[model samples]
Target: MARIPGRNPWLAWPAGIVCAAVVATLAWLALPMVPVVVAWVGESLRTATSPPVAAPVEPSRAPLLEIAESDDAIDCRRLYPDDLWVELAWRPEALLSQDFSAPSTSVASLTDALAPQVRVTCRWRFDGGGGISSTLARVASDSAAVVEAALQGEGFSCETAGAVLRCRRAQGGAVEEHAVSGDLWLSSVETGRVPEDYGARLAEGLWGAG
Candidate 1:
């Protein structure tokens, strides 16, 4: 028989089948990888073209007002306009008196009565409208005594309102009231640590003088 120039039928068919299956699997696996590669390239381009974001700036706060210290109290006179003035004092201890009738002498007489017992004293003065008023408090003393003392300082008549004492002063067109409680000496009107309304009332009472 002549030598057969024949192909190996078994090898040819199996090799072809094997190659086709491998090609199909490779295409299936590469399908998902295509989108990932495209997305990565897009992100890189975006990063190369875009500018960096800037940091935000913050605002600064206002400075606090300064106060001057004296032997008797903290002074805030300079912070306000020349027409307005205020002073405050704090003491560790003082003697207080019972609310009593206004003395026959000057308001200073009331202080003279309590001076024997007061250990510490605090005082504040307010001047405005060409008129000046003062408030004084003696701590660690009886609240009544403090009220009486404040009344005496202001040249006001004294009266008891519940546990507190009130004193009034009348001069020119103004009537001023000093309401004392323990170590607190508040004007009838509020101002500063006190209320503006109270201060107004105080000024009205003092100015009205009626």
Candidate 2:
């Protein structure tokens, strides 16, 4: 038989040493990047799980009038406070004041167009002769413009009192007043022996003294 070559255990040592050096070099290169890789993954997960923020909304304006919507007529007593009625020297018994008919004013056509649900008509008469007819009507913006134009055309003295547009015209003892505030319309016709500040008083009745 041919002599078997002696096993070279020393030759395997160099190969094992080369493999160990390769693994050590790789670990040295990769160790510095470990924290950076962990931080990147954590940031991505946090962003994905976070909730979004919303924008704020604005509030609407408050209404000037406090009257409710109704088809039925509002009682005259409930329109103004008791102290005001007393100050005006108006009798509670003559709330309707049927002795004389409601005055015929230029705004009759405009009043006709208003629905009862949005309109409040009040008449108060004295036992002597003269009385007042006041109408508070909530109208559309377009209708309000028409009413304002009509008053200006009728040669009424117009002025701005805060948010209220007041117009007045007087012929003999009859004094007619018209006021517009936003979508609200007020028309008062006073015939014979009526207060000079009747329109102002009515405004106070609708809003406050202010």
Best by TM-score: 2
Per-residue CA lDDT of candidate 1, range 1-210, in tens?
Answer: 564478777788899999999999999989999999999999999999999878887743212111111134322232222223322222112112222223222345444644432222223333332222333334343656755755675666877654456666656555556555444333422222333334434322322211
Which candidate's lDDT is highest? Answer: 2
> How many residue pairs clash in each candidate at the backbone level?
21, 0
Clashes of 1: 21
lDDT of 1: 0.44
What's the lDDT of the predicted structure labeled candidate 2?
A: 0.65
Q: Scored by CA lDDT, what does every candidate get?
A: 0.44, 0.65
Error of 1 at 13 (Å): 66
> Residue pairs in steric clash, candidate 2?
none
Candidate 2 regions with alpha-carbon error over 4 angstroms: 1-64, 68-73, 89-104, 112-118
Among all windows of ten consecutive residues in candidate 1, which has the lowest summed lDDT? 61-70
